[model samples]
Target chain A: MKILITIQENNVAPRFDLTSEVLIADCRDRQIIGIPRTILMTRPSSEELCGLIIKENISRVVCGGIEESHLQYLVWKKIEVLDAIIGPYLESLEKAKEGTLKTGTILPGAKKIRSMK
Target chain B: MKPVSFATCNNFPVTEILNGVPHGVAILDRDLHVMEMNRFLEVLTGFANADARGVHADFILRSNIGNNEKLFRNVIETEEYLSISGDIISRHHKKIPVHFTVSPLKNESGDPAGLLVFIEDISALQCFDKKRHNMACLDKILGHSPKMQEMFELLPVLAHTDATVLITGETGTGKDMIAEAIHNASKRSRYPFIKVNCGALPESLLESELFGHVRGAFTGAVKDKPGLFRMAQDGTIFLTEIGDLPLTLQVKLLSVLDDMEFFPVGGGKKVRVNVRIIAATHRSLRVLVKKGEFREDLFYRLNVLRLHLPVLREREGDIRLLLDFFMREFSTGLHKSIKGYTPKALNILTAYAYPGNVRELRNIVEYAVNICQGAKIQKEGLPRYLFIPVEEKPPTSADERRDEYSEKAMPALDLPAEIGEKTVSGSWQDVEKEMIVEALKQTGGNRSRSAKILGWGRTTLWRKLNRHGLA
Candidate 1:
């Protein structure tokens, strides 16, 4: 199975339409197959991303704050969507792997701290 | 300073006080973890306080706060407050504009304990600003006069229908702008809006340009060309200067209006289109019909819905308003600090009849803004032709003075050495090119600043620059 997650830096992007980076992971039997592929788009466009999902044969999508029209389109294409989920992408990915990821899930955990350049 | 513990302070319900505040309030520990949040914060963020507690605030309130560790550390070290305006995404995926105030919280021994953050929703204020901006300029047509106000009210009513529209006005009175505004307000706005100028092209080319031509239709026709009517399918086709359309093309136009179909030049088959027709002219089509210059049936068909734009000179109380508007716009665009016009300058501007209407007024303001060095626009900054003799009192009635000048009853105006027209030479295009070149020279080839100096937007300047081979 293939899954796509929209991300900004390390955390899930707040809006799907404004996300310019996406991670695609190929999994089998609810376990990881290899390292996830990170794709960086030249610009943020939900329509282009939707087309990318179909072209890549993605079966599942995890994102934050997706509009209803896009959600319906993905559903129409037989792709499962877990949206309105916020937190670090790593934790979200883990939950998705474990089959515990739910819509509108706000993951709670310690945050990464780093100094400014 | 000794830190007073809130728990030690008896008879005070700190949580209640925090919850009673109007703004969203949240308490975060030094690790940038959400320790507690009030009811308002929960409602604003669309997350329950219980669920948000202990989670990183970045996840709960997804804002532009990059690297929370560094930001919180800076606030802790500096012991200073920071306020910023940004947007946050709620749990329901709704983006809300908000202002945030973050302050450091201290414990005993003057050690940093946590942070206190306040969030204020600003969407209502933003909505009000947007409403005010739309009120000032409706579809880029600015006028506060009662007649213009009535026309503004009628535009939407006309746009809702698919009736053929005819816009009549003098040159430079913004007839094209009215047609565009109607098209923009209509459902067909989602499609293309193709504009064709009947006067700009010759007769044979004009017909082919409107209805297109097939391969080998004319001697120069090399390929099949989809005409403007076909290109504007499911949209609007604006015919400007319709009075200039020749009698031959008028019959073809009338048939298209009646049947929504037309045959390409030399094409046997008729091409059907679903385009809306919007025709504009500066001359009276009725008068043209009587003169045998225009077809009466076509004129009547095109005039199903008529809109006549009043000249700027006749729009009462609008001259001063437009002058002030242009003055401020040019001042800001030119990066000048001009506040207003001097009384003498204002008198001359208001008394002069704007023969070229609003477009001319805008140009004059741009010219004045470029020359005026002081905060107020002085009389010397105005065009030389607008200046009456210093000894003569300014005219009290613009119409009467305009008529006197038209009848040649007024004395021949003395040509000043600094006459504005003398600075440029040749036809209107030549003068415009000279002005653009001069503006570019004045701004040292800075396109943005040159555009401001010429009272035009950057894209307009860019297109003109390319057209004149200056780019």
Candidate 2:
């Protein structure tokens, strides 16, 4: 399975629409298999990201906050998404690899999680 | 005393001071790591200060500037203030317009310490701008024809009054839009503008639907329900296809229009309302009255403020305008980069008679935008039905052949002698083209007057002009 996570520096982007960087990783048996590949965007656009997700055949996505319409579209496309996470990107990636990541998850030492829904 | 250390400076109540500010504020160290942020900033970005501390500023506040890092670096090195305005994606992933200023912060010893950022939400301003633009584009009827111009001028006057309006037009001639425009332009615009299609429901159900029903009014009535007429109090109630109303309901409608009071189904008490009535129908009320189907008294009541809407084929020069409008609308909505229609496609669209009128034109443009792959919509993008040539029917019986021969035997009616002189030795198509050209020249290129002189609709003239390559 291929997983895609929107990132900013070493942390999850605060908002999905503002993300300009993404990490794509290959996972098997609930474990990451290789070094994650990083893709940099020239500009931020939800439509462009949607197109990329379809083109890359990403099965799962991990990100911070995401809009309702984009989430609905991703759900309709049958792609699993864990969003509204506030934490370091590596910690979120590890949680996803372990199949323990969930929506609205705040990492250790982080402040209280605020629901966006 | 020695200069205050950076650790000592961090011990200050930075969060408290920053929180007191109206707008969002953030403090970042030289390494670009977020050291402190205000409560407003935390709520705006959906990131708690505890989680945001030590995180890169780039991760928390995504800037639209292409080289945001370089801009921050320049601000840190030069110690100069920079202000910029752009959009930021919030916790809900909604873009919020914002204005932010970045300035250098100094320590107690007067040495540069860190960068201070101030952000103000400008989403309300952006919303107001968008509303103004939409009001300009969507709140008016679009037409340049003389008949439509007259209606446009009269709409405001009619909207100012509370009289009942009767709008007559063919299907898809924009009667609904006209009614809505009148409502929007009226004093009751802030109130509800309810619409009910009279023809879509049966007589039995329509009564209960228009007028509220009391509990146990019928087999299925369990509770008292307010109707559309009540819902449109002090507003407007647009009754579409009013000609389809049955005789029994017609009497009830007449009473309501006369006294502005009606009793609910199975209710003894009468309910009064102050709703403006706007009735529209494609059928002729006079013919229905002649057939003993429509109430004559009700007809006269509705006929007090009559508005006759012209068919699409009669409204010259508006097809292209509507086409361009719908094309741009659909292209933006579908995220396509469709520039325009190809020459051949445009010619075909211009020549085809829109039996469904503007609504059909909008639907066709939407479909074309979806299927069009190139920058311009081509002939292949059009619906298959548009490309199919209409087959001509052959004469079936002896009477038809004789009638056809007689029709061809007679000289063209009302043809100018000059056109006859020029097309005497030409084929039928040539003669037809010459006659059209003569009519156009006589009318000084006024298509509407030329069409009237040629005894044809405006769209027919447009089609012929394209066919003869004279347009």
Candidate 3:
């Protein structure tokens, strides 16, 4: 399975539409197989990211607050989307691989990090 | 009424007073932590009083306000009331435009204690403002013709209703824009407005394009794809040149229109969609139906709400209005401050017949703007083609003269008498074929001229030619 997570400053980007960086990882048996690939976009666009998700054959997506339309589109594409998460990127990826990450999950020490601020 | 003193209301609970107010009110400490909040604030932020009691104001508001610390410090230092408008993301990720006001709150010893924050949702007001602006722009975009004015009045009513609309007009008459305007003004404005040109694609690809295909549906089908209909779910799909749709696909389209459900090409599952269909065609579907090229049943299904856009030549009164509109639009875009058109230039433009409609007019304006060096666009700024006079050459050969003569005589002659005199002993089909061949020959194989001579649309003439095996 492949998982894609929109990221910013080593954390999940607060707004999905504004995210310019992404982390794509390969996983098997609920574990990361190798180092995640980082994609740096020239410009942030939700449409472009959605295309990337489909072309990359990403089975799961983890991101912070995403618009309703985008979320519905991903769901229709048969991809598991855990959105509205406020957390560190590494911890969210680990949780996603463990099948424990859920929508709106605020990870431990997230408040102290204050990434968006 | 006399102004009440604060000391008179000192015994009343500040929280009670704040709760009675309509707007969302939150009192933040000097550290920017929530000290107290009204009922409206609790509901607006989706956080209860007890839960938000000690939380940071930023966490509860979740606004895009960047310099929060500086804003709070400035308000405290300045001790002046401040109001600003911005967007705030709600707990459900719904972005809401809000106006916020921060006022300094003082302690008993006259020292700054905290800040009183007022929040008002202005999303509705913002939407109204945007709608008013779009309506004003739409008026200018649609033109000031009487036909267009009628459309403007009917457009809103048509948009409010969820029904299939069939728009008929000549090419370049803004059929696509009408479809878009309807979609933009409809309830599904928030959703995607998908457009597909029915004539642009081939039969094989068009099926899969409108009704998606599963992976391995064909040789090149690498992955499953959702079609335009699915993408336009809960919105609108503007199918331009719908008359060009193949007969085989017309059956499937009819089924989808009737049931609001369709099976993708090579996909077993039925995809139920709630999409409004707005089909446009430059060709006459009624003529196509009479010629048996278009299905009559499908025509009836799509023509539930018909809108026929008038040709530009018919609405000559709007030429000047459209000219000025396009001038201003292109001038501002090109960063050129063109004053206006010269009298000669304007007269030439107004007199010319615009076969390409408003689109051609816009292109002309754009071209003129690009070439014009002076404040006003002169005849010199016009396209070179506009100045090239069409030369009417006389017939050079006996055959050409005879053909030209027949071309002029056909429209005046009685059709049955002409066909009867040409065909002595033959079926009606043979007589019809002879008449078509004669018209085609007289017009020098010009389909449009032959159609006009035969009192038929161009497509109807083409169908007749195909029937006679001449095309």
Candidate 4:
């Protein structure tokens, strides 16, 4: 399943620039796959989010953390929204590929990932 | 329920509640003496009724129940109900989580006569909470408070560009941590993080220390050495304790910031090093600039990127967190098994104002680890001064500070004596002659430049040279 990772800023790519999307994936096997993952701007309004949802055909919308407005927007768009999964993004992305990701991790333990998965 | 007289209610109601009421009750007089306790108190204590009246609260129930005397007294003073939850061990050593409240009594004149304390065991709820909230700390470097979440959000935005950062806070307040976080999250993470403490070395040595000096530069100059600027080429140079940089050095630093190229102290050849300078200072640099001690231009240059560290006291929320973190760190490093702090120690810590901030907290934890024997650290295990803050660097004595200032002023006032030392056992009159000759020899005998270098009036300089042996 393809996952859409919300990046804070586009300028952070290159050296330590790992995808924050994979951070929402599976922490056990964090992989980036180097595929062109859509880096959506953060906390967009409902209409803006809806436009991006249709544009990217984003099956799952994952990010570091989502505010209530953005979370609601994604939920309405029928795009699965996950936030709070932490770590280098590549690791989270790999978890998403494996389909074992628990949502809203923030760090590692705010909510129980193992129990949820 | 006919109202019983004070004397009968005291001894009997205490014993009666042990059997009748589900809650624990203890009655105290104007002096907090246990005039009467209910049957529930007896069950809670596993004791039979006796002459338990007229005993002090601490003596009647010494092991546990409400250990915080001040909290208890507050209830009495406020004439309001006060509730708190803590561990309570019975006579049989059975631990019960007690939620206790104290309510005061008023006389017929509507004045306080005594205090009444009620206790309810809350072990189950408190235990469940402990298990739920015991997860490992996630953002150890950034901290775990909502305040830190705000800082974490700023880190990425600050890293988006190459703006020079100026971090300000009290010493040991994680200014360096924020600087490191910026670099780590910035485009410059791959480059080196070179740090220099401006206050560590004397200003004379520091000039050469920061800007490389060529061989034969001064009396002790042995070989050419690269300064931090050359070493940190293309990386971030964190100028820590920057407010301490001397006035002379501030000018050089200002020029360096403006031109982005600084000549080595001794090297006739100019050297250029490309580096981003991030400065940090605990002192009020703005005040220093106003006093003309720090360069104003340099202050503006470094102020391009500003980050302030919040003191630990302001974040009373983080104390419990930092305490736990330091405890774990000390436990692992010392290989000890300290579980936590006793009620008294935690109270003492909560009351304390940690003057040294996080560094002081770390030191306290390590000190406790060395002496702690059991799982819990008691109040006595902490350093004596912790009971009272401002332990380090006691208040400066006014008279003593005046003497210290005069002691430093004494040397600068001895200009005649310094000139006399140049003659060294020669006639006092000829001493003036000898200084000019030495100055001339040192400066290739250029009188024009020597007159400018020395603060002597030009006419006075010539008169002195003639008056002495240096005709």
Arrange candidates by lDDT, descending. Answer: 1, 3, 2, 4
lDDT of 3 by residue, B204-226 (tens): 99999999999999999999989
- Count of clashes in candidate 2: 0
Candidate 1 structure quality by residue, lDDT tens digits, B99-153: 9889998877678887888999899999887645533335568788898998999
**Model 3 error, position B320 (Å):** 5.0
Winner of 2 and 3 under DockQ: 2
Query: After superposition, which runs of candidate 1 have C-alpha atoms over 4 Å from their true positions?
Result: A1-117, B1-57, B61-139, B387-471
In the predicted model 1, the residue pairs found to clash are none
Per-residue CA lDDT of model 4 for B1-471, tens digit only, reads 112244445466435544576777787666565666777776775433353454445433433332335555667788888766654544343556678777887666687777777877677788666533321121345366676667667767876677788988766678877776666555566688788999999988998989978898988889997888888887778899998898889888888887778888778887887788888987777878887878888889889988887766677478788888888889888888889998757765655556466877788888877777779886557765443211133433323333433353211111134322432334434534555676677679777766654446778778877777465
Complex DockQ, candidate 2? 0.14
Compute the lDDT for candidate 4.
0.62
lDDT of candidate 2 at residue B87, scale 0 to 100: 65
Using DockQ as the measure, which candidate wins? Answer: 1
Per-prediction TM-score, please?
A: 0.61, 0.47, 0.54, 0.43
Task: At residue B54, give the lDDT of candidate 1.
Answer: 70
Measured against the true two-chain complex, the DockQ scores of the candidates, in the order shown, are 0.29, 0.14, 0.13, 0.01
lDDT of each: 0.81, 0.78, 0.79, 0.62
Model 2, A43-90: lDDT tens digits are: 888789888998999998998768879988999999999987767778
Q: On a 0 to 100 scale, what is the lDDT of residue A109 in model 1?
A: 33
TM-score pick, better of 1 and 2:
1
Off by over 4 Å in 4: A1-117, B1-142, B389-471
- What's the count of clashing pairs in each model shown? 0, 0, 0, 21
